[model samples]
Target: MAGTLGIGIITYNRKDTLRGVVDSILRHTSTDFEFVVADDGSTDGTPDLLRQLNVPCITGRNKGISWNRNRILWYLKEEKRCDWIIILEDDCFPTVFGWERPWIDAIERYGHVNFMPELTIEIDNDISSGRGTPEDPFIAPMHQAFCIGYHAKALSYVGYLDTRFEKYGEEHVEHTQRFLRAGYGGLSQHLSPERGQLFYLRGGLDTLPSHSHGSHELAMRNKTIHDAIRHEPLYRHPWRNDEEMFEFREEIARVLPGPAPEPEGEPQLFDSIISLGGDELVNQAIRNHFGRPGPGLFDQFIAPFHTLVSLFRHDFSGLLSTNCLYGYHDALRCRDTLLIYHNCLEKQPGEHASVEMFHAQLPLLRHRFHTMIQEIDSLCHRSRRVLFVRSWRDGFLYAGQHRPAHVASVDFQALVDALAARYPSLDFRVMFVNFGKAHATDSRMMFANTDTPDTCPRDEELAGWSRLFSTYRIGLHT
Candidate 1:
């Protein structure tokens, strides 16, 4: 009888890494699963060494990562006919608990589906490695193993990874997004950082980063492929409705995929920002407020606040760099948390839309607001809208009691001014706060009282946003 699962690993010239990945998988996973090793014309002794291993493998010409993966998909159809195929990278390894029956059980429960195994990055010594661990092994948007997926229909639908990426990045996310667009539900494993650490020893990267040397060629190829994808529009799931598109976009983020699984026993730290409403509205407001609809207030005022807060709360650096991470962390935590928030107003907004934007960008505004619930992982909870209100005199009230290190109530603009004034050399920046129609406004001189809406027509509206922001760790304007 044939095994139910097969593994497809894509490799280039990294022979040692490939060997380690293969050895690790065979050792950890006892289930009779076929392993498909697809090579992209690795000039290094990778081709010869594969013959020595005597494992079921596939060899192909020097195409991109996406094409290499497609070639393996071809093998699965023509030769293996596997019930399911697990896709992996040569540098990644599988943990002893990686082949747990629960994972297979999850596949059986939600089978023939494209799933993103849980992903965790292990920084062993200076070398960072990503492998599946027992605790938090679920589907995600990074370099991860695709599991519980059959060899036939999925291949036809996804058509292998996008050949745009000659070596690394973009392929996994694009593939997963395509599956989701096709109305296929995928299972994401729920494992922890601790679980992810088991397979990787701490060490710096020993091999040459794939695209570093040939960046110019890779960039040109990526541009060509991306242009093609634009016209062709790769995602075509049956469930391509507006809501699904928004949701799929958000869930499809490359940065910290999904909410950080609540640490096993700890109380959750960051709250949901979805209750605040869509950033599109804020972008629109900025467009209307300013003459030019370029990347202005929304980029300056709104994006920074969200990005900075997100940096502290989660490692979801979808499009941000390590330098940015270090800078953000240093700014926020170096002194008192409140002080950091107080001082950060002078920073510039991150202008580019990165992995975070790709995942969070809802094609439509209303749908975008609805999809944010997934980011917080509080989809099941009561929703609230967040608003920041302030008066020149009530600055002390906004300061509040001993503030949580992670959040502040004052207007972000004020924080920037304070920081800029204190540090003459630093450039203070306005926090990016998308103000959609949700922002409560009143013609009357007095502020609206939300509790008694009839007496204060604007009160309910203002209170609605206040409640929303508060739930999401945002503070109310005094």
Candidate 2:
């Protein structure tokens, strides 16, 4: 007896296309397979459409494309409804008969195949693949995520998709990489275009960062190679329950092929691009996402070192090394090296978006911060020059308090005092530069409500830095 087969689709927002897709798959695909459609928080009538169609649906977990597909596959495998599974998008529909048969047969012989029809258009000229026939498809150097069909055991052998990556893309690419690494490389290939017909609606989404677009800052890409690489992945899942997610991850890890070999060299510490939001919620973004500054137990324990490490952002450009250092631009007076770009924090707008964006970028930002901390260690051990800069928009809190209501009030002086007490440093100064209106027009202002120190960097603040600055510790290379 033949084993069971399963089909899964992941859809978002587009309702009409989804309905048409369901209709097309039901009409074609001349084989028996259980079908499941995952809805990614479609505000449209997709939920009702799925209901009318009567296919099993994975609802409420609109985390992203990777998470949705993983949920469907997990459900099918758990229920033993499938010995083989084919994954598709809402827009990917079968235009020819035997659609599911060829895929199921291909997975058995070739391990896996990305369903595709004859290329009326060219693909091999660039990023997609080189031309090949149906009997033995071209083994392109990269992991293809489109129209993927594989044995359900592939999920058990290789790990499930990495949900940390957002819907924009890369999750599929990473999954393919891990799949290949588990000794399944030769088993996967693009379908012989001669045998399959797939219609892909050219939704301009293929150009966005979430789809097939440019690299978003720290994302790893290897278009030219077929190697599996793992950077620090973010911690994200669709389930609201933490314990459940932990248990799920543990279960998946138990079945995957062993972890990759340890990397040889030390990992990189700095990233040049920083997506920072505007002054509105920058402080909270830093504390909750990147991390807040304070004297922790180890910091207090090592107070005797009196080291200084400056947290810097934006363009210090010519100011740090050249003629621009003399307050030509108030923000540039204190020169700090370029780490992560300042604009990266601005990816999301409101609080929930803030939380989501925070999770996505936290791992990369933490690595950069850790690199800066290592430099701080060197400074405390050697020259003892500390320079830290954060564009504070949120109000300050007392040492122990986390929420705003728990603390009375804090200003620039308060921040300086907080830093001094935490660091146990030799000398500390809090300087402020006015880039906005002289006063807060309403209850909220761009900068946090604090005594705006009119005493900007001048005279010794700029001149006597040699006494405080260490040629070794500043991390400033001219």
By lDDT, the best candidate is: 2
Which runs in model 2 stand beyond 4 Å of their true positions? 116-134, 185-478
TM-score computed on alpha carbons, candidate 1: 0.37
Per-residue CA lDDT of model 2 for 1-478, tens digit only, reads 3878888887787777777778777888777888887777678878788878787666653566667777667766765458878777765777766667656665665445563333423554222433333354444444345467767666667656665565555666656655544444343333431122211211111111123332544244332221333532222243445543643432222222222222435421211111121232222322333334221211211110111222221111211122222221112121232221223333434323233443466576556545545554444334343333323221111111011122333343443444455546523223222112222222111221121121223332223222222211222211
How close to the true structure is residue 62 of candidate 1, measured as C-alpha lDDT? 66
Model number with the top TM-score: 2
Q: What TM-score do all the candidates reach, one by one? A: 0.37, 0.42
Q: What shift in Å separates residue 147 of candidate 2 from its native position after superposition? A: 1.1
Backbone clash tally (model 2): 22
**How do the residues 1-478 of candidate 1 rate in per-residue lDDT, one tens digit apiece?**
2346667777888887788877777777767776678777688988788779876545544656666676566555535576566566665556654453444433334333333322223331222333232233333333333332443555556554655466644554456545545434343322421112111111111222333224666666665655456335543341224443232222112111112221244322221122111223333322332222322212211133334344324432321221232123323212222212112133346543332332343244224323432333332233232122221111111221111122343344333343234333432122222121111122111121111111122344345334433333322212
- Alpha-carbon deviation at 17 in model 1, angstroms: 2.4
